[model samples]
Target: MMMHRQYLIDQAIIARNILRVALPLQRLRASATRPTLPETPTRFAIIAGDVTDPSSSLGDLAMFSALMQSLRAQNPDSIFTIIGERRHTIVVPGIGETPVEPAWAGKTGTLAFDELIRQHHALFVMGADILDGKYGAALVQRIVAYCNHSVLLGIPATMLGFSFNRNPRAPAVHALSRLHPHVTVNIRDQPSLDRFTRIVGVLAQLCADSAFLMPSATDPITEPEAWIASMRQEGRTPVGINLNAHALAPAIAEVGMDQLIDHFAEQFKRAGEQNGLAFMLLPHDLKSQSGDVSMLQALDQALQRKGFTHVRYASIDQPDKIKRLIGLLDLAITGRMHLVIASLGSGTPTLSITYQDKFEGLYQHFELSLEHTITPMQCLTDELLRKINDAFMHRHDNRARILSHLPRVKALASQNLAIATCGHTD
Candidate 1:
């Protein structure tokens, strides 16, 4: 009881401080502009708590970055107020570098009660995973607090490029349903949009996953160093492999980790022997304890245990560089969403071992067959090798199909930005 009361008191103080600083910050922003301008436009952005994250943010930051580019192109007058403990530089696809900082760790200072948030035009809440209001989730508290407060204040709040794991009851249909015309929600897949509109009674606009619209990553262009030139020259088809350690380890804990690693290695070895292909391990994250970089090592050790040592591993933290490497492959075998996004975005053929709805959902969005997907439960069976062989054999045709579908998908993603900024989809 005391803890809950203290929480409310802290919130009250924070809100009061923000309210107190609102007018001065408004005055400061008002002073910066031209006399011909009518009013200063600002946006309140609520990103996931880990704004500095690379892998866990998944490919959502790439989409958010693309959205930032669109906002800069269309709504030049807009400034942003981001909410997080820490902020860092993220390469915004085509727009180069943008700092995603609205607050620093443990310090409110002058920007503490952000004027843009207090007297804001719109609120944007997004992340790869947080937008899914699942139970026992931490970030949804921020969304609930911010959106509810903003809606009550008559500020337009938008949930941008997110998915819902389940219909939220704690912050369910009430606040959003009541906000009516002021709130806007854009989802990346038809499945998510259908669920939101059908079960939750909130209207959700369909947009291609924002990752599809991110500008060609500079990682491949900027890095210049070849992470895998020797292997590329070997005259055999190269396959890019990304295993999602975070999801796979926890979800498949019932299966021993060593056995799981051996299963993948054995399959890869079989695929190599059958198809005359070389494999390259690509790491998508470096900072996290359980990120792709560390996990790649574990898989490598496992492969060594089985006397397989010829497989090459590539360590890269830049999303763009990862995309470039994925493009070099004849086929991508991945459990991670961003790896799949980078592979297919560049029209690199892919076969995914999916653990979440996001993968199957996005693949469905592209009208691609999910026959190539295998679950962890199906990993011990022969289905893994079958999909691997089939996907590689028909990779060129799949690449062409992906390329054919891309322009249309990119345009729809752009329409999502248009609707958010200009209130029109076309």
Candidate 2:
């Protein structure tokens, strides 16, 4: 059944790719003339990861927040605008809710998108796996088109901090290959760098995820903070656990959601009983269906049934708060990539449940071992239990390893911004 569903998705992607190439839109062609930078303050048109969604993943929000904050810090006088649906309002981390300009006034063509780009000095696309087409072909196609339009208009454009899997869509590679030299493509990890270069036949630049630059909350909130403090007082190590349903969909399909939940619950129960560790449920996504909240609730209920009161839910409203709280943990076991970033970037030990083959490259950035990551299939067995206890037992060493390589990793993340702006400060 899963294979059939995937086959249909692949067919849809192929159909869309054929149509995109066959029916080319007007003003979407390359231009021989190039435009120079303006003497006045630059206007940046941002293509954020998730700006308009109400139930946005805190990870996506964090990446967007970090990017915007970094840009503002570098160019304080520059004007910024997010290209998104005007109907939806976006709430950034430090800066509250913000309004956005519509990507299209009417039709889905280059005329309107180009007119929008012509108003800005440059275009910045936050490439957080959205360009891969495996997630959504239409989104990847639209962003690619926008980038092509921007570069053709003589404006600097960049697809920053992105990754590609082993088998990327051919259309995405083709589209990326045809981009103007004015447009820069920055791959987030080394594996993705090699994969992209091998497929596209272009030497794409390597960088780290933008979320690594996000600052943790200074004024900590209560609840989880107080709860973690209480656990420390009792001589227990606080461990943050994040399990997202979106990443585990394959595993859920293979077995069942309940069975998978039960498996994790049993393992966590054993870990708590044997190790005397306090657990915190840290949820990143708030979507009703595929979000982490439901899975977190299920785990909480299951553990509650087993009379495990040592476990508590982590506060997850703001990215900074959750990031700050995650930093307080002795260690973390997470499925979401952003959670792993937040954990490791904070110098906290993390054991990740990796998907998409992306984590291996991320761990490579930190000079950590692949043993730090496990697959969804491994979650069903004793491997997860063994890794959890093992990670906790060697928490200090893992923390040291993460901290040792954090400086270089952060410098790589900051490089994404410099490349995106074409080395222009103003």
Candidate 3:
């Protein structure tokens, strides 16, 4: 039954891709024969969280980068202004400065927040995190007061991948809806969309996660030679484990990272004793605050205690780290949404340890089995190992299934960019 469902989804995806390419080509040819259209300078204000904080913020930053690139390609005259943490300034070039602290507070710094909005035609407000009641309300009021168009690119209720334990600034969002008819709200998940529609009295448009648009390897990306060589020497199936121990969800705690790692380490150690394939711990978000590095270190220590010497760690700072990490994986079992996204994007089979609805939605979107993906809070190691083994056994089929959706994901992102920039009229 699952195979039949997957086949039907694949057929629909192929049909969608065919239409996307053909329709765009026809539009291009028609435009070419027409008189040249005058170029317009569209200023975009992307209200985002601090990029320096590499938690869920990385997903937003990556999306912003992709959107900026896409917009530049379509409209060279367009200018993008990012309002977030000042520390993020170094990573994103050409971003105009804004006061970082009290992000929700209205115009409490040297920068004239009101004046900046008056100059721009549209404001693209990211996740509701930036919309804390008083501060968010003030910011929204200022934007509505200044800009002709404003949109809240919210995470849809259907997108089960994001961590949404904290209730977003509903009062502020409500205020914006009441103040301006031009104000629009959209979410990434289906359930959120339904609830939002109930609150706002309007059906929100559902969109795919922006992370799908993240850039792939631009350079000669390859796995670390040292890591790959060491794996071959150990003769154990190289499995990448990304466990989110400090996750916001308490359910994740129930899984007990120590037990999870110990079981996998022992299993790999036994395999290594016979044939030599070692398990490698790959921490996706390894920053100090995220606590991924510390968690991995603890797991490393545990593995060492078990006499497992073939384990390796992938440094996040390394060049082409994402590509390198994904490439090295024979299989990936991860709790981080982006790691799963990256692995699937790179055609690497992955078993997702989901704590939120976003993971389930993504699996549904790609027509993958939810049974293969588990919630850590469940702590079913036997089931997890079975899923991991299944993923490896069906690695080729899974990769092909994931690859089939990439073109569609990219096309949807392009369509969203067009709507974000060109669809809004001043």
Candidate 4:
């Protein structure tokens, strides 16, 4: 039933593309409601994903924060308005919720949406991998429509740094291929660049992920700080673990969550004993379906049953706060890509539980080895313990490698900001 629904949706998208070319959209749009600009050149509209929602993934907030921070640094006089559904007030890290204008409610290709676009000098679609069509055809259509409408109205539009998966849906590829040449689309990694060019048949400039610019908290939270201090006092290395159900959906479906928790608990028990390591459970995503807190909590309980007292949960709400905690770790292991980004960006040795083929491109930016990543199936065996021990032993070398390549990656990340401010993909 689900596959049939997706097929019908894909067909609808293909039909929409044909109608887009056949219909006289320009004449129709010109006759629609027109809104005059406020003469504010710095006025910008940020769309896709609400940065102010408390329930949002910290990773999403991290990207939004990075974009906001970099934009402000490049142009401090910039005035901003979020263009999406209104969200509950959740303070952005290092950036409070009150300063920015409230979200303007208007869907793409509508008269109201057109009026709103005219008021802003520029429009930025926060693609962040959503344009790949895995989410749905509706989202892919909406983003592309928003960009098309913005460019037609003479306001510059830019699709911020995003990734294209190994196999993007044909409908998404078709929609993106129709984008105006004036619209600047930035693909984050080389593999995604290849995928985008092959499918969309358009030129997309390369840039690093924007989460690299996420600012760390001023100081570590008391709980994690105390845990780290105690571990060092006993001469044990602090290892941070971030696990999410989203990445291990297949494994959980096969072996159940309880068995998976038990498996990790047993491995951590043995590895900690042999390697003199203490563990920290770091939860990155907060959504119910893929939330990390519940899984990490269960693993913590299982670890306690095995008499491993060094394990603790770093319960930090803000992305920057958790990033600061990740920075303090001697080594980190995670299924969450943003957590891996935080660790590597902060010069900490890290291992990734590979998913979606996104990690290779990220690691390539650091010139690091793919040996640092493991599959979900590997987590079920003693191989997990072996990898942990190996990573722990080579922590210094990993940290040095990450630090050496940090600047170049950061500069590439900053290029996204330059693209936004300077209004060019080059």
**Clash count, one per candidate:** 1, 0, 25, 0
Indicate the residue-level lDDT of 118 in model 4. Answer: 70
Cα lDDT, model 2, residue 385: 90
User: How well is each residue in 112-156 modelled by candidate 3, as lDDT tens digits?
Assistant: 333344345455655423333322334433333322222211111
Worst 10 residues of 3 by lDDT: 152-161
Tens digit of per-residue lDDT, candidate 4, span 206-280: 988888998898874887888898998999889999888878877788799999999989998999999998999
Candidate 4, after superposition: displacement of residue 123 in Å?
1.8
Stronger candidate by lDDT (2 vs 3): 2
| lDDT of candidate 1 over 231-337, digit per residue (tens) | 55765677888776665754347667667777878888888778877778876655566457656777777777777665777766556667766777789987777
lDDT at 410, model 3: 53
RMSD of 2: 3.9
By lDDT: ranked, best first: 2, 4, 1, 3
Give stretches of model 2 more than 4 Å off: 1-37, 50-55, 104-109, 419-426
- 1-426: candidate 2 lDDT, tens digit per residue: 987886777666546644553234332434323356675536777886653553277877787678777877777776667777554567878656655776632244345455567678878887877777666655665676677666655677888788888877655665666665567888899998888888777657899998999989889778889999999999888999988876787888899989999999999989988898899998888877655888998899999888888899765778888889999999999888888999988999888988887788898897787777778889999998998888888889988988999999999998777644343211
Error of 1 at 6 (Å): 22
Whose lDDT is higher: candidate 1's or candidate 2's?
2
State the TM-score for model 3: 0.69
Worst 10-residue lDDT window, candidate 1: 417-426
